[model samples]
Target: MAEARAELQKKETELTNAILKDVSDIVDAIGYEGGYAVILRSEVVLSAKKELDITGAVIRRLNESKGKPKEAPKVKPKEKPKDKK
Candidate 1:
């Protein structure tokens, strides 16, 4: 049971890290074009001027970049457990 739990936790952590890395990459891609030094999510800030907003630009960039060919991360196939007769 402990081994199974540890394996599950490891898988969860890997999935979480992959998701975060993807988010970071997307933000970097948007920032590369927007020239923004700081980008905050909507829920994080209390109040900000419209001129300081980069959300619209990022959204537009995302839409424009959609359906483009992207490099995929290579994945190794998992080994299957042998069944006992």
Candidate 2:
């Protein structure tokens, strides 16, 4: 029973670590600080603001580049009409 409990606890810890790593990766990719305050508590409003600011800047840059030539949208093939015999 003790071994089973220990194994379960270890698995829980591993899962928690994996979740933290994923959240950290997302925060880093979007240029935000990763922490419980940002993800859970509402005390980290400044961090959230900064993250939004960064995202807005990225979007603005992308929009500004829209004037450049881009590939045409792909057209879907038209289906042939069935013959009514």
Candidate 3:
């Protein structure tokens, strides 16, 4: 059980890093345009000021970046054969 939990945590960290990297790219692009110096990770901070919070914007941008969800594959139904007339 401990090993399973550790593995799950490791995967979660990897996924979090990937998401943060993508969001950071968007933030960095905007920051560079606005002449901002640097952006810090929210998690590392002890607390955040309201203006510094960009969680909503990041989520919206992430959704837009990913586009619409993909359609699931269709499944064929089984058919029965007719008897000789």
Candidate 4:
């Protein structure tokens, strides 16, 4: 159980890191294209003007890059053991 839990956690971490890296790359591109001097996360700042926020643009770009979602792989169910008397 512990081993399975650890493996799941590792996979989750890897997936999260990959997603963050992709977002960072997209944001960097947006900044370069928009001539932004600096971009800060909303969490880091107390408040910022809506006009300064490029989150919508970033999301739109991300969606465009992603295109259509791929179908997930199908998993087969395990069979129950049969007992013979």
Index of the highest-TM-score prediction: 4
Name the lDDT value of residue 18 in candidate 4: 89
Clashing pairs in 2: none
- Which of the numbered candidates is closest to the native, going by highest lDDT? 4
> Which digits, one per residue and each the tens of the lDDT, describe model 4 over residues 5-79?
999999999999988888999999999999999999999989889999999998888888889788999999999
Query: Residue 60 of model 4: what lDDT?
Result: 87
Compute each candidate's TM-score over C-alphas: 0.53, 0.40, 0.52, 0.76
Candidate 4 residue runs with Cα over 4 Å from true position? 71-85
What is the overall TM-score of model 2 with all chains considered together? 0.40
Q: State the weakest 10-residue window (summed lDDT) of model 1.
A: 58-67
Residue 81 C-alpha lDDT in model 3: 86
lDDT of each: 0.78, 0.59, 0.82, 0.93
lDDT of 4: 0.93
| lDDT tens digits by residue: candidate 2, 20-66 | 67555554544554223334334545445544344454445445544
Clashes (N, CA, C under 3 Å) per candidate? 0, 0, 0, 0
Candidate number with the higher lDDT (2 or 4): 4
Clash total of candidate 3: 0
